[model samples]
Target: MTHYDGWFMLAAILAAFAANEVWRVVGVALSARLHEDSAVFSWVKMVATALVAGLVAKLVLNPTGGLALAPLWLRLGSVAFGVAAYALGRRSLALGVAAAAATLMVGTAVIAPGAPP
Candidate 1:
């Protein structure tokens, strides 16, 4: 006996959309009244920054798939190398992401699993 069918899936999708959109609508309404330099805005900025940093730390510490094949120190060192490339390249966003991805792929090839580092 299955608990879910097409109608159930439709309801789940609609409910997910509603749940996601409600907050977006609220944020849109709130955005109009918020000043860019206000305390609330600063708090929001700090929260956003912290969330990004946490995500990056998580990725570096606990990677998945191909990234998981590389050792932890190499993963972290590649991130540092990418950040250095980004800063030295005038803080280009593309440069940073590309450098990090390339370093990971190449580093993985050089010191792949079942081989010495």
Candidate 2:
């Protein structure tokens, strides 16, 4: 791509990100009056959590691009072990990431030594 094209692309990306943040900022501004324990807020939180969980599940079960080369069982097992570790460690993000990486490494070694490109 030309220099001008790259600049245009960068500007477009920045504009998209800024547009997305506007809604987030609006939400934060309105949050003061919104009851934290209200049904609507609770439902929204649940939906958000569910969406994240679904995305994680999809990534583990059917990873895209480079990850698709790995064995399916290895991915699923890694996620399971990671969830277990996270629960045992009281939902610590660092421990969860480390556990997931460790699990993925070990699982791949044991299950898919010759996984393809």
Candidate 3:
């Protein structure tokens, strides 16, 4: 590798750290005055939730890498299984996620025996 590559990588790391650090500091400063019950906080929470939901939907519908190898039915079914587990397990996030992962693994194994383990 060229000598300049190390300096470029260092610069990229510093830039990323600075970009993230600024937002973290800003968040910390704002968080002190924000109340969980306040409208602003609620709005922020709703937006964050919406973004996460959108991301999940996108990933499930149009997956990448190894996940893309799995059938669409299996992907969609895993989501359903996860949601059902979440509701049935008293809204336990951990249980829901675990159930979804297990479903995907078993389903993939059963349907595509040649798939990488």
Candidate 4:
């Protein structure tokens, strides 16, 4: 509504964009010299993998919203099915996730017939 407010909002947006873009530019510059076999890259990969595993554990053990609707047994069983599918399907991450999601959906539908999706 005010003239200065519009300019302030524009400046804030530009600052946020610059803050994010700087990291991306830095990452690109750093990545050019880093080989996949380098120790630094290996460490980064390990850290990233650990973070993903932690996130998955958190989501499975303590889900919220729609996921929390299902019983704990269903959640753990779905994870078991996913891991088994992943191992049986040539270790394909996509197949494992899809199997887990499908298991969860079917289990929820069967276990809670009137539950909201």
Superposing all C-alpha atoms, what RMSD in Å does each candidate have to the true structure? 3.5, 3.1, 1.7, 1.9
lDDT agreement with native, every candidate: 0.88, 0.85, 0.95, 0.94
Q: After superposition, how far is residue 106 of candidate 4 from its true place, in Å?
A: 0.9
Candidate 4 lDDT over residue span 20-99, tens digit each: 99999999999899999999999999999999989988988999988888888998999999999999999999999999
Ranking by lDDT: 3, 4, 1, 2
In terms of TM-score, how similar is model 3 to the real structure?
Answer: 0.86
CA error at residue 24 for candidate 1, angstroms: 1.1
Least well predicted 10-residue stretch by lDDT in candidate 4: 108-117
What TM-scores do the predictions have?
0.79, 0.72, 0.86, 0.86
Tens-digit per-residue lDDT, 2-116, candidate 2: 9999999999999999999999999999998889899989999999999989998898777898777667877877788888889999999789879988988776666667765
The per-residue C-alpha lDDT of model 2 at residue 59 equals 87
Q: Judged by lDDT, which candidate is best? A: 3
User: How does model 2 fare in lDDT?
Assistant: 0.85
lDDT of 1 by residue, 12-79 (tens): 99999999999999999999999999999999999998998899999999988666778998899889
Residue pairs clashing in model 3 are: none
Distance (Å) between predicted and true CA of 68, model 3? 2.8
